[model samples]
Target: MADPVAAVAALDEPNRRKLYDLVARATCPISKDEAAAAVDLPRTTAAFHLDKLVEMGLLTVVHERRTGRSGPGAGRPAKLYRRSDEQIAVSLPDRRYEAASHLVTDALVEAEQTGEPARVILNRRAYEWGADLAGQAAEADASRGPASNRVTEALARFGFEPLAEGGSILLRNCPFHSLAHRHTELVCGMNLCLISGLLDGIEASGVTAHLDPSPGHCCVRISQAPSSRSPSVSR
Candidate 1:
């Protein structure tokens, strides 16, 4: 998937954004001339912006002969632009609602098949998924570091935004913020289990995952395990 930030930034230019809106609102693919006329831009300038949008994955391109005649007198196929099927979303602090939705959907399907509680399946699957994320991070970079630093680095990439204060790693952002607001108990429980599984998979025995909820932050926090009391900090 393309970076959401870059994809969104591509539309920051006025002419590019206007051409995008024009093409997106059209029922069928539109040629550069049609888009330029609709948006009151020169055909060449509109074509440049349209192609840039295509490169950014905001639009897709196809060539088609607009004229009915094809064999003898038909001109070359006109390049048409349309909105791509890619879903682009940018959230402050980087929320992962889509990931939460997929987990919930999977749990529902499995629960229906096995006659197990959806919540149970959700918590288990979330933990497994979290562990998988940590495992992938470990595989990507094999350097050894403090447990807290490893946890912070792993969670940061997943949009948890972990911040170290004194001896504990406080998560400043919850990836499933919106879902957690509507279903606090269920989502928070799943979050706790997920972080716990991450700690387990990463072999971060020096730290423990806790359900310490506060406003504007993730419910999961990592603290130094009592037996391994050592001051480790990271941002």
Candidate 2:
């Protein structure tokens, strides 16, 4: 699991946080001396804090020759630092507003082009996005030893706090709680479809997703597949 807390905590120190902001604001990777001059700190002080940020994964370090020469007189290569490409999200209970935004954005684009209803497009796009996530998860799992119970890990990774309950997995948190509260029918229906697609993408045959709505819980629940059921999601 990505630790948002660690990333956030790393920025608590005032000078370290200032150095991070300076590097992040730069259009390109910056040298420690340049960073020190901007922030009015000694080069050694700047290097110390900048290295700490790199250690925390907030910044990435690379070595490059500042001068356009490669001879002995060109001097030593300078170390450059820049903001890491990794994204940092710090939701207290872990919300997935980005996921909601992606589905809605895709829906709008497809609806505009295909002349389909926005809601319909939203559902289809959401399912596709979920499947893409599952596909990526599968690839990652393949590289890290044999596959185990990835369903629960996948759910948790996507911010749907899954709780194992006998043969079923109950979702404790809905990443789209605020949106779902306002538009329960639409959001819940979309959730069901997305999870269904995820299950199919992961190729888990014995388990299935169902629409088991309860207050303060996700609308979808995963359980052992029934002998017979409709191809579509149930309410």
The best candidate in terms of lDDT: 1
Deviation in angstroms for 138 in model 1? 5.0
Residue-level lDDT for 18 in candidate 2: 95
In order of listing, the candidates' clash counts read 0, 0
Please identify model 2 stretches exceeding 4 Å from their true place: 25-29, 37-42, 62-77, 84-86, 143-148, 227-235
Residues 132-179, candidate 1, lDDT per residue (tens digit)? 988987986689487666778888888888898998889999988888
Q: TM-score of each candidate?
A: 0.78, 0.80
Off by over 4 Å in 1: 64-78, 135-149, 200-205, 226-235
RMSD to the true structure for each prediction, in A, is 5.6, 3.6
In candidate 2, what are the lDDT values of residues 1-235, reduced to their tens digit?
Answer: 2366887798999989999999999998999999999999999999999998888889999888878889879988889999999888789677888879888888888889988888887777767777898888887777533222788877887888999899899999998889888998888888887887777777666788888988778988988875423235323
